[model samples]
Target: MAFVLTSILGNDEAIKILSYKWIWSEEFLNKIPLYLLDDLLRHYNRSTMEEHKLLEILAIIKKDFQKSSENERFRD
Candidate 1:
């Protein structure tokens, strides 16, 4: 899974996979390590393409992570 996430940017099919809502779900996102997510964010930010879906996916992923962390903090 991490391999797919990390290499997705290199290929069209993989990049297309990012459009699916399941890819941004908490369960799938939680499966990915923070380091990898950070790396993905960096790559997404560095992208030269104008207003790509990857950016949108990144935003959704970040929002989900922020909400998840806030919920955890509230629980604590």
Candidate 2:
């Protein structure tokens, strides 16, 4: 849809986007174990799967938030 949207360059759209949290949601916010964030960080220190690492490293934090809209959380 790049052709459908206006160009963000030199426009106020970029600023508007940066100021907002498009990725934030009830599910993602709740799933992120804030209390164990430190422990989670430890996982990145060791060697791990390349694809998973690529997604975690290259993907923006907001992009992950956006992805949550499509992917669902596990239910008990």
Model 2 quality (TM-score)? 0.23
Question: Number of the top candidate by lDDT?
Answer: 1
Task: Report clash pairs, candidate 2.
Answer: none
Worst 10 contiguous positions by lDDT, candidate 1: 67-76
Specify the poorest-scoring 10-residue window by lDDT in model 2. 1-10
Residue-level lDDT of model 1, residues 1-76, one tens digit each, is: 3343455555664544444555656886775567655655566555632345445545655565444532232221
Candidate 2: where is the Cα deviation over 4 Å? 1-22, 37-76
* Per-residue lDDT of model 2, residues 1-76, tens digit only: 1111123233454333333343245654454445334433555346332444334432444455354442243323
How many backbone clashes are present in model 2? 0
TM-score of 1: 0.34
Candidate 2 has an lDDT of 0.38
